[model samples]
Each structure stands twice: as structure tokens, then as C-alpha cells.
Target: MKPLSTIVQAITGCLLIISCNHTPRARTVQVQSSANESVKDYPSHPKTAEELRQELAETEAADPAGMLLISGTMQENKILIQKPDLFHHSKYATDGYMISGIIRNKASIAPFKDAIVRVTFYTETRTELDHKDYPVYKYVLAQQVTPFELKVYPPESTKDFNMEVVSATAIRN
Candidate 1:
């Protein structure tokens, strides 16, 4: 008979395998059936040329940092770890859910390599979840440019949890 800790380890490993699966399998997912049907009934209204330009200007003024372009599949893959690589994870109880992904800058730029990409996943309310509440929290570290996969972690429930990612600006100090 296997020990309790060993059985837990095996189960966690299985969860990791399952969560890392990116293949489009022939499975049925029950999408929300009550989506607002009126969305289709609404009359078509196209934005005029000037109106669209003004909207774009407004958006740019609001968000100066260009949005990160992440395709759906790429987004999923970006959450996986390498099939095999060195991984180190530890919980840091801070004001909120904070994550630091160290990446060596490959560009010719000098001081960029000394900088790191810091991502903090704070709750919508800006509250940080405790380490114990989240049984499975994966920390994925990959190259920002050509990230094939992210750090894979075991599957765990994260219902109603929302997270945002923001890369910190390089601190010259």
C-alpha cells in the first residue's frame, strides 16, 4: 500500500498532466445557453470613420502601454511550463497575489537583462488570496518573446477568481 503523501504526489502529478493538455479533444462543454439573444437582434450600426478615430484616440490616451497580443491557443500555452526544466516555487504572503518571473534579456540592451518581469495577481477587489486557500497555484516562467509553454501546475479550483498581469517597468535605480 502506498503512503498517503505518495498517493497525494501521484494525484498532483496527474492533475498537472491533465491541466497541461492543450489538444482540442472531442469533448462537449456546456456553454451558457442563456446568452443575450438580443445581441443578434440589435440593428447593425457601424462606427463612422471619424468616430472610430476618436475612439481609438481615447483608448490610446487611456492605455499608453500597448496591449499584449496573445492569441487564444498561445494564451493557453503561455500558462504551461517546459516539458522538463528547473522549477522553483514558493509562497510569499504579501499585500496581494504577487509573482516574479525572472527572464534574461536576449536583446543587445544592457540594463534590460538586470530587470525582471513582475506580475501580481490581485483580486478584482484588490485583496490577495492566502496560500492555503489556493491548493493549486502554478508559477510559469518563460521567455516573453517566444514562450512555448508556461510553468505547469496541478489542477485546482479557482472559481470566480480574476487576475491581471502587468510587466513592471525597468527600474534604473
Candidate 2:
């Protein structure tokens, strides 16, 4: 009888020979294209910024206040809050805190109005103290920026605050 090692080597050699002898067939795929097809026919490329702006303007001109509602995520993504200025009032009669910032509309096709800004107040230890939502009644055109302000009374422990555009009314017309 053949030794175990010899038998194993023979089996391995047979496998190697069999594998080496069997070759996979090469496949060539042919793609058909029409010479008459124009770039406009595909319409797969993205629109240019200028083209988008023009389209937005035309839509707005045709239908002002056509967009009644916009999603919160869409507003958060498109309406950006920039250059926030915070002020503290000494008198209690006036709201204790004032926040002013720029609302930039990054949406290519929709204008936004009446944005809801969410202010989250935090303590020195980074613990959240309170949050408030303020509405800014302003019209922000697409690719434009507008200023807004909010007055609120925050907890005395508030050491820092963050503001974000939570939602807005989109103007489709």
C-alpha cells in the first residue's frame, strides 16, 4: 500500500495538474452605440448652477408662494445659520439673551421664508440646560443670505448656545 504522505502528494499533484490544464474561456462584451444620439438625448448630466438659478427665478416669477410647506430635514440642509452674534441684557424686562445671525439659503431652486431657529443652551460642563425655537419672519431667496434676530430668556446656568435652522416655508412660486 502507498504511504500516506505519498498518497497525499499524488492527490495534490493531480489536483494541480487538473487545475492548470483547465483554462477559463475569455468573454468579450460588445456595447452598441448610435452615432445619431445627441448629448441632449441622454440628459444624464447635472444642470449648471446658472441654469438652476435661472430656472428658480422663472418658477418664482410664475408662482409666488407656491411652496406652502417644506420638510424639516430639507430646511436644515438648505437653510444655513452663519455669523451668530449673542448679546446679554442687564435688565430683566427685556429678554435676557439676544441672538442675531445670517440665514443663508443654499437651495438651488427654492426660496425660504419664516425660518424656525432652534437655540440649545448648554452649561459650562457641556450639559444642556434648555432649548428654544424662534421664528425669523424674513424672505431668503435661493443662493442668498438674510439677517435674523431672536430674543429669549435662558436659564442662568447657560454658558453657551448653538443655533440652527430647523424648518422654513419654501417659496416655490
Candidate 3:
């Protein structure tokens, strides 16, 4: 048998040679689904400001009235008619009902113009009798309120009335 010191040295030299010959490579792991298929990860690209503006312009040009309609519908909830008062007045020898209220725009971004208020007339039993659309040709800024008074000739059986904003043109500047 070899001497103990020499045998230890020989073993150490062998281990150093083996370690120097072996190099580590990066390993890539791929996830697999239950169907034995590899799952791919896709990167998402977001729209830029210019692209969004172009798209909006195209949409507006395609359907101007439709765009207004959509915008009005989306903003209907944001428009509020507050402090409404219903009364009758003998003006111009006509018995007409007058509705006065404040139109409040709760939107924080867009100002509205040419808002239409729909006054729904109802009977004493809470049944709807008729509805009239009153055009308010006024500009109402965002987070602002405007006062409006409209004269309507509702049916004789109109005992109750409710007012709400039906449509408006959204001015995005």
C-alpha cells in the first residue's frame, strides 16, 4: 500500500481535475399543463396616447350622432336634476305647468352642452301619463349646476311629475 500522505495528495489532485473539467450551464424550465402541452407566456402591448386619439377621431367621424348618443347614455347617470318644483301658472292665457330645477353635472372630466330634460307626468296612483322632453340649450361645466325652467302642457290628469336628464352632448376638451 502507498503511504497515507501520498495517497491523500493523489486523491486531492484527481478531485481538482474533475472539478475543473465540469462546467455549469444555465437551465431553462418550461411549465406544462395537464394536457401535456407547454404554456406560452405572451407580452402585452398597451395603446399610446396618439393611437387612442386617432381611434377616437375615427369613431367620431364614422358616426357623429351615434357617438353623441353613446356619450349621453353613458353620462346620463352623472347628470342630475335637483330641487325640482312643479307649479301651474296662467301666462299668455294658457294653463301650462312649469317645472323649475337645477341641472347638476357630476362628471369631473367632460363638460356637457345642449342637455335635454324629460319630464314624466303621472297620476295620483303613480301611473305614468305622459312625458315631455325639454331642451336646455346651455353649457354646463364639469362639477357645476345650472338652473332651468320649462313650461309644459301635460294632460289634465297629471297629478304628479318627475324630472330627469335624458341626453346631453359631452364636450371633451
Candidate 4:
């Protein structure tokens, strides 16, 4: 008996003569990207000063709280409040550890004046993702300058938790 390779070669030779014009196609695979929490890759969307102000106005009406939700597009660097200096350790079980950060609004947009910020955290639960088992933290505008919201998670003993910020509508009207 002939080898399997020889048989396959004969079959290919037949096809090659039949379709002499058509070239052999290449085989490849493309896999989709998996979701990773820590890997935060934000796309760049350039916005003019005027456009930023307009978006700030629209977002103002949309949410009563002036929370600058980090999004893929639209908002500029000013809209985001990232505390790189602060550490976020998810894998570790941090009990009685106080994790805090500030929720602030962009100053470039004047319409968002006095945008009061609100903060909340969710605990890692068995049945749900962000369970409100943790304490509900709140903040109201008390002064001229923006300050960080500092408080302990779970109020007593913090397990794995996530942070959230809600900025009240800056519009005084």
C-alpha cells in the first residue's frame, strides 16, 4: 500500500490541473477579544472645547447628579476622575480596610457649576454582582473647592468591593 501522503499528493495534482487559473487559498483563524476587568483600554476621541461644553450641558440634563461616567467616546480627559495614586486590590480580602477616592466634575464646562458628587460601593455577593450589602455613602457640596470622598467600606468590615460616584446636577436653576 502507498503512503497516505502519496495519495493526498495525487489528489491535489488532479485538482491543480483542473483549476489551473485559481490559486490555493490560505487558512487562518480570528478569535474575539475576552473581557478583562483590570485591562482598561479606552479609545481616543478628540473633542473641541465648544463640543466638550455642549456634551457637558447634555450630560447635565440627563443625570441629576453630576457624575462623569467614564465612557468609550464623547467625554474628554477632564470628564474622567482617575486616582492612579490610590491602589485598587481586588483579589485580596480586605476587611476593616478603608478604601476611598474622590468623585469630581470637569471644570472646563462652566454649566456644570456646583455639581454635587455622590459615592456608593457594592460588595461581592454570591447571588449578585454588586450587592448593596455595604453601607450607602453620600456627599453634598459644602464648599467652593472639590474634595475627595473618604470613608470605609461595609462601614464595619469590608469584603471585596467596588466604588461608584454620582455628581448632582450643577445647574442651580
Residue 130, candidate 3: C-alpha displacement in angstroms: 0.8
Residue pairs with colliding backbones in model 1 are 80-150, 80-151, 81-150, 81-151, 81-152, 140-151
Which model scores highest in TM-score?
2
Cα-based lDDT for every prediction: 0.34, 0.67, 0.65, 0.43
lDDT of 2 by residue, 94-136 (tens): 3255566677666556777787777788999989999888788
TM-score for all predictions? 0.18, 0.50, 0.49, 0.30
Number of the top-ranking candidate, with lDDT as the measure: 2
Local accuracy of candidate 4 as per-residue lDDT tens digits, 105-163:
44333334333323233334422233232222343232223434233334332234444
Residue 134 miss distance in model 1 (angstroms):
15
**Candidate with the larger lDDT of 1 and 3:** 3
Rank by TM-score (best first): 2, 3, 4, 1
- Model 4 score (lDDT): 0.43
Write candidate 3's Cα lDDT for 106-167 as tens digits. Answer: 55445678877777889999899998887988877656777766767778787777777777
Candidate 3 stretches with Cα past 4 Å from truth are: 1-94
Worst 10 residues of 3 by lDDT: 70-79
Question: For model 3, what is the alpha-carbon lDDT of residue 44?
Answer: 80
lDDT of 2: 0.67
